[model samples]
Each structure stands twice: as C-alpha cells, then as structure tokens.
Target chain A: MDKILKSLFDFQRFAGESALQSIITSVEERFPANEEKSPRTALTAEEMDQISAAGNAYLQMEKDKWENLVNGGN
Target chain B: MAVIDGEEVYLLYRDKVRGYISQHVNQREEVEDLCADVFEKVVSSLDTYDSTKASVSTWIFTITRNRVIDFYRRNREHAELPEELASTEMLDAGLLREETLRELAEALMKLSEEKRTIIILRYYNGLSLKDISDKTGISYGMVKVKHQQALKELKKIMKI
Candidate 1:
C-alpha cells in the first residue's frame, strides 16, 4: 500500500514547471497557502549572505574544473 | 545542453531552491547549508544533465527533494520517513519529460471536480485517504472509493 502510494506521488517529480504549476494551482484551490500555516519563514539577512557565498564558491569550483579539463588536467 | 555557465544557473535557481529547502528544514543555518549543497551538486554534475529528459527546474526540484530527504534520514533516525519523501525508483527517462506531464495535467483536468480534488489532495499534497476524509468531511470508505475511481479514470484517459 505504501509502495503504491509512493509510486503514485513520485511521477509528479517529472512534471515540468507549467504542469507542476497546474497541480499546485489545484492544490491551492483545495488548500489555500494562507489558510494554513506554512513551515517557510522569511530568510534572514545573514542566511541570504550565506547562500550568496555558497553560490560564489560553487561558481569558482566549476570554473576551476573546466580550466583543469581544458589544460589537460595538468 | 551542458551547463557552461554555472553562475547563471545558480543565480536563476538560488531563491527558488532556498525557498524549498526552508520549507522542509527548520533551522536557518541548515537551510542555507542545504541550499549550498544542492547548488554545488548542480555545478558538479552539470555535464550529466540532459535538457530533453527534463527541464532545468524539474532537475533542480529533484535534487532539492533528494537533499531534504537525506537531511531527514540523517536527522530523524527513529521516526518513520514520510511516504512522500521515501525514495522510489526513477521511472523511464521518456516518461520523465514535460510532455508526459502536460498530458497528465490534461487528463487530470478532465476528471470530475470531486475526483480531481481527491486526486490532487492524495497525490499532490501527499495526504492519505484518512487525512483527506477528515479535511473534506467525507467518510473514509467514500474517500478510498473516490481515490480508486480517480486513479481508474486517469489510467483510462492516459492509457497507462
């Protein structure tokens, strides 16, 4: 039973933004986002900074990886 | 196409990915960490992405979902993982395309209002039949019946 339900729910992951948006539209129609308390809270400034730093780090890592490959991994 | 510009992809998806992580993770620091981890993965695995199989947003969503699942598994050792978060085998790549999802959306729209509501509640919201019964004020038996009917209808419409 659980396995069946998992399979049913899993397919939605394949749904693109537009299709997922439609399902979300239906979900919100039945269950309004504001009517219920959401777990998400406004991100603090520090957290935002942290995320920015992480992005910069990843960008640098990706750049280095590409450079290494281009340089024949020297 | 391979992601030649990692920063571009990161900038585009960072907020959306952060929002999703914040929903599943309570700690502010952990949310930030997970968001970073997800983007790091996106950057590292850029070569593996096939745009034809799924859209960039869908790919990011899958990565985010998996990270949250891993977070929960690591943190909540004693508690049962929600059925919604439990990993399932990836379906065939052809079926994972946006076209299939569009077809599914069309089929879902064709369902009766009652059946559509039940299906969205069950699958989209990850609510169990009993939970749907309580929320909709329907009896458990009827919710189950309607859920089955909705699935049957979808199968017929989709020929799946």
Candidate 2:
C-alpha cells in the first residue's frame, strides 16, 4: 500500500512539473522584447566600409556604436 | 557582417527593455542601471550571439528581463513574479491572463511555506516528487499531498 501510494504521488508530481514548464514557455513565447516599427537610421555604405576597415585593424563594433550614439547626441 | 555595437543595440532597445523591466519594479531609476547592465552583458556576449536564433532585440530584452528577476531575488523577499510576465503590450487575452498569472504568482506566495516550497520544487524546479521528497526530507506521500494542496490553492486564488 505504501509503495502504491508513493507511485501515484510521483506521477502527479511529474505531471504538475511538466504543466508548469509549459505555462512558463507559453508566457515567454507570448511576449517579445521590442515592438519598434522602424529600424535605426541606415548606416551609409561609406560609414559601413569605414567601420569595416577599422574592424580589420581594431575598432570593435561596440566602440563604433558608442561613438555614433555620442555623436548622434542621444 | 558588421558586429552590432552595444551602444547601437542599447539605443534601439532601451525603451523596450525599460518598459518590460518597469512592469516588475516600481522604481524608475533602477531601470536605467539595469538597462546598462543588460547592454554590458550584450557587449560581452556579442561574439556568441546568433541572429538566426532570435532577433537582436529579443535577445537583449531576454537579458534585461533576467537582470530584473535577479534584482528581485536579491532585494525582495516575497517576489514570485516571473520574467515571462513582463509584457506591457496587450494581447487579445492578455489583460486577464496577465492579471491571473500575477495573482497566481502571489497566490503561490500566500500558500503555507511548506506547501509553497513543495510546489516550487516540483513545478518551478521541475523536480520529481521522489526527488522533492528526498530533497526536502519529507515523505513521498506528504510531498504529493502538499503539492496537490498547493495547486488547489493556486487555482482558488486565481478564481477569486
């Protein structure tokens, strides 16, 4: 009797856990990070090439981005 | 492919991330700090980031959401609001579902500590009943009963 009861409870616990995980997954899938309509102002080909050239030597994207943000004054 | 700079990502994502985090926290100031942390993580993780898997914004916001959850864990004692519930935009069923989930999380908080612990162990941690019983030092039958009771309480809480 003891073993049978434990087995039943064990099953219940497994099902419950699975359900919770699904609910959690559902919630995540339902929400997204951004709803922005437009992309950022386009990087000109020259600007892109400059970033690319700098990248070949050193200027990482992070630095370029920060510079742009500062320059853009936002 | 030009790597996305953290600033560009932060500039584009700041508002969305702020909106999402604000749902969890009451303070306005901390949101900016958390946004910075999220961007910092983005910069550090950029090499491994894959656009194929998720949009860049989605990826950053996921980090932002996680930082908020961590903040809550470190600062708040009874906070059970999961990061998944942070959407400000409404879905067709969004309002009611959000409220129910919020209440459900709080309801879990309202359960007896033991019952709440079992449910979290079994559900949140995805532990098997046997594992939970072993971990908590409770008998298997008792763990099952507590978890079942907790679920019932969660349902009752949601219903009301």
Candidate 3:
C-alpha cells in the first residue's frame, strides 16, 4: 500500500524520461508552470559513458570474485 | 542464457538515474558514483528480476530512489527526508508499473484544483506541508489536512 503510494508520488521521476515528459505536459496543461523549475534534464552522453565504464569494471570484479571462490583460491 | 545485460541496461537508463539523483545530491562526482552503484545492483539482482511484474524502467527507478533515500539517511544533509521516500517499503513489483502512474495522473485530474496542486507540490516538487502553506498562503494546519485528504481520495480513486 505504502509502496504504491510512494510510486504514485514519485511518478514524475520514476516514470522514466520520455514518459515523464508526457506526464509533465499533461499536468502542466492544467496548471501552468510558474516559479517552479522544469524537471531536471537527463545526464549527458559523455557522463554516461564514464559511469558505464565504472559499472562494467565493478561487474568484472564481482565475476572474478565468484570464480575465485569456486576455484577455492587455487 | 544471461539473465540481463549490464551495459545495455546502463546505457538505457543512465540519464533517468542521474536526473533523479541530481534532484537530491548536487555533487557531480557523487552523482556518477551513485549511478554506477545502481547499475551494479541491477547486475547483481538480474536473476531476481521478474519482468512480468514490473517493467525494467520501473524496477531500476525503484532501486535509484532507494539509493538516494539511503544517501540522505547516511548523510542527514537534508535535515528531514520526505516521508513518502523515507519509509518506502520493499519494492512491490506488481504495483510499481508505469500504468499506476497514469492512473495516478487520471486520479489527480479528478481531484479539486486545490487538492491537485497540493498533491503535486508535496510529492512532485518534494515540498513539505509547511513549505506548501508558506508558498500558497494556506495555514499550516489546513495544508496538512488537505494533503492527507488528498491522499485518501487518491487511494479510493486508484483503488489502492
């Protein structure tokens, strides 16, 4: 129940990028944007590449750990 | 078969993840670190993901939100976390669908104008009831009551 409520509240961000834009358009049509800032923009491609590298490295480390455990540190 | 492709998922939702994180955390480095953490968790939990229940987008965002909430809990920089995000229960994958959001939007449309605005301000904008009162010129107590009433109406309408 609370989870549903939280997801509903988080719809703006949790709906993902394209869907969020549509929701904003639908809502803003009813209530005009005043002083509030528009929703935050998505991260840039370059930034994403850097993070992707880091994330892939972490995955590799985990994979290595599993293999080592299976091999009993041989 | 591989449960999920880590790099593909990272490429797909990285923007959404960082956008959500930047709302709560300002430092660029911390934002990138948190984004990486979300993907790592995605990879680790890939086998557990049940796509029939929730879209990958919904699942990733749930993890992303929890990461932000955890960050705030650890640092206490925000003074107080929004109760909506603070006490979020374990992800109930079935209920966190994109359709639920559409239903919520439709439900908000049914609400009176004042109630709708209060709900959006409190949740979408992450404003507190008192902050809402200050901004809208409503008394604090009135704002609090309306916020609760709005939630109750939403629950009934969404049949949650």
TM-score of chain B of each: 0.79, 0.48, 0.75
Model 1 misplacement above 4 A? A1-16, A23-27, A30-74, B1-3, B76-80, B87-94
Model 1 per-residue lDDT at B136: 80
Most lDDT-accurate candidate:
3
Candidate 3: TM-score of chain A is 0.45
TM-score for candidate 3: 0.63
Off by over 4 Å in 3: A1-7, A17-74, B1-4, B69-82, B90-93, B130-148
**Candidate 2 residue spans exceeding 4 A from truth:** A1-74, B82-160
C-alpha positional error of residue B141 in candidate 1 after TM-score superposition, expressed in Å: 2.3
Residue B68 local lDDT, model 3: 80
Whole-structure CA lDDT of model 2: 0.58
Can you write out model 2's per-residue Cα lDDT over B1-160, one digit (the tens) per residue? 2377777876776776777667567778987788778777888998888765655644564576568767876777767654233321112222222223344456656878677666655544446889777666889999888877876776676563
| Tens digit of per-residue lDDT, candidate 1, span B67-139 | 8888888888654555555634343334444555677778878988777788777776677789788788889
Docking class of 1: incorrect
> lDDT of model 2 at residue B158?
58
TM-score of 1: 0.65
lDDT of 2 at B110: 80
lDDT of each: 0.72, 0.58, 0.75
Best by TM-score: 1
